[model samples]
Target: MADILSILLSDSFWAAALRIATPLIFGVLGALLCERSGVLNLGIEGIFVAGAMTGWLAVWMGAPLWLGVLAAALAGAGFGLIHAILTVPLGLSQHVSGLGVTMLATSVAYFTYRTALPDVTSPPRITPFQPLDIPLLSDLPFVGPVLFQQTALTWLALGCVFLVWYVLNRMSLGVALRAVGDNPDAVDAQGLSVYGLRIGAVMAGSALMALGGAFLTMSAFDAFFFGMVNGRGWICIALVIFASWRPGKALLGALLFGAFDAFQVRLQTEVGAMVPGQVFLMAPYILSIIALVVAARGADYPRALLTPWFKGQR
Candidate 1:
């Protein structure tokens, strides 16, 4: 136990944990945005895989890494548009529509990555962006390297915490979004375009989710694999509930889950017999369950959640 604690103190542990948490952080933030706007995006997992496949395909095609990222974002936006068409325009169930999108994305990634390009592999799985070292801070004794030295996407994810906080808590657009989520009919009565705003929210949310996926394939893993997204998407869904739909709180949730996941790997490496590796791997889910219970005890979910908003109809 003492050795494990010591290992936890090392810069490598923190860096690895942060790297693992990056995608989840992005997905959680994206989920926060959509859920706060009264749109449920369950296709995060599928979108994530799609982004990975899309970005990887772009890189394999000799395009610049930034271009690959752009492709991933576009792919995500495309999925978001489909979500708006199904849920907002067609008045379909949010969960069903999101699930359908996820299924479609999974299929796209599969048939494309596995079926189409199995023979042509290139670039040797190296990510485009390199980790940046903050001049003074990165050289600090222990905490510096862990906190200051990270890939560009890690810094971007951290910045997004504050950015999302400002957007959701301090902006008029945010207030409007919250209003729509809480009471879509009331917002509609105010002469606001509910469908348009919700559509924007969905597209924005999907774009963020897609970026998270790209980060995994490009910066984190540097390659694409079938079902490579693991369950980060589902984990982000739980994070929204745990954070009570708040962006800042979602960061803390992402860290907690990230640490748990990190610890699980280390535990399995050191003491694989005492606790079944599977049980240790379940830590994130178990923590998510506990967090959900605590959060729901006093949660204030959007009033319009899962409720369809029809123009001029209460």
Candidate 2:
């Protein structure tokens, strides 16, 4: 057991853990934004898939990798607009609208990927985003690769965690957003634009979702595939509740889940003589369920979450 623990604590293990956690961090960030603003974005799966496909498509078009990344963010925002249209403007059920957006986005991603890039047998693999090797720190033994030599996106994700924490806690916009989530009517009574704040929150959430997808295609996998998101969206939803709408906690949760996933894959490979890989693969799902259960016990979810705020409703 000590030997096994040592292997798990190796630099390579930590590096792989960070790599897997990147997408979750992005998704959780987006989820944090949406849920804090009283919107439950069940469409995270769709947004992720759309971003992957679009980012891949852009790469196929011979565009710069950064352009492909930007395209993914734009794709997310577009889908977010659709979500806002149905749930925010039309007063549709937030749950149904979110699911609908997911379904529609999924179809769009599949058909477009197939029809437009028919010759592509698999998702076109591109260069993984470049890693930044810190001059002094990257040379340190054991922890360098894991902490210092990660792709630019990893650093960005970390920065985003802090940025979001600040924005949600200290900024004026954050206060207004919380006001809208807690009671839009009161926010309206103050003559603030509830609609505008909601729109901004949705767009912000969608952009983060897109970045998460970009991490999968442009950094982690270097390619996209059908249903590539594979229920990660649901995981993000659970993570948001588990983190209690806190950005720092969201980052921590993502890393913990990522470590679990990394270990599952490693265990399956190392102990194939004893256990089935599928069982290990299911570990992350089990963790998600456990988290949801714990969070549901005494969670402080947004008071107005999933409640449609019609302008005319007093």
Candidate 3:
């Protein structure tokens, strides 16, 4: 109990929580956009892996770090387009298409990584993004370091929460998006192209998802590795449900998950041999499952979710 309390009160623990949550926030916001448009993007996990690999590869190949990040976003957008084609125009099963995409993306990343660095004698590395301390904010007590001192991507992720909320609640595009998610046929009756809107949302959302993956290799760690994403994509799916599909709520959910993850890491170090490290590692996932169960009943899923839309078919 004393050890847990000490760790909880430490500034470093909270800081780590924000750091861990950054990618989850990006992923949840991305998933939120696609799901809100009546599309269940299962390709997110693949896009994430693809982004991490492509971003790291870009930096290794001598491109600027920002350019690498852009490359990752673009790669994610490309995959999103493929998913849009499969689920929207082709009228395929969203679940199958999404899973196929994940398999393809992850496989392609592994192949590319192996081909590029065939000799694993020395793994490639890059100068990852470093933390930047916000002047006045970082100087404050308690909240300063935890909230203010983080990488640029972390700040951008925080901004994205607000951006998604504003776009979903305050903008005309948001209204159109929500309408399409609830009733695409009605949206079509109003002369808007449901396909176009969905495609746009998927691509845009995927770009953000890839950016999250890029953060893993470019900011979170200096090198890319197999299984680096480690099910964060799946966690985002549960988070979207837990948040009731709202961006603000998603932020809180991400933080909550992140807190569990951070605490578990601390717990493992404090308990040492008393508790197995795997148990601590499993805490976040177990909590996620429980959260999903609790939140599932009240989740207001999009009305048109997982439904294939054909213009003239009733």
Q: Among these predicted structures, which one has the highest TM-score? A: 3
**lDDT per residue (tens digit) for residues 1-314 in model 2:** 77579768789888988888888998999988988888888888899889888887898778888898899999999998889777776768889888988898889988998898779775667776887899999989978989899988898888889998899899988998888888989888989888888878988898889788888888888777887788998899999989998999999899988888887777777787797667886788899999999988889988988988988778
TM-score of every candidate? 0.93, 0.96, 0.97
What's the lDDT of the predicted structure labeled candidate 1?
0.84
Per-residue lDDT of candidate 1, residues 219-251 (tens digit): 888777766787889989988888889887888
**Ranking 1 against 2 by lDDT, winner:** 2
| CA shift of 125, model 2, Å | 2.0
Candidate 3 stretches with Cα past 4 Å from truth are: none
Q: What is the lDDT of residue 82 in candidate 3?
A: 93
Candidate number with the higher lDDT (1 or 3): 3
Better of 1 and 3 by TM-score: 3
Give me the candidate number with maximum lDDT: 3
- The RMSD of every model to the true structure, in order and in angstroms, is 2.0, 1.3, 1.2
lDDT of 2 at 215: 86
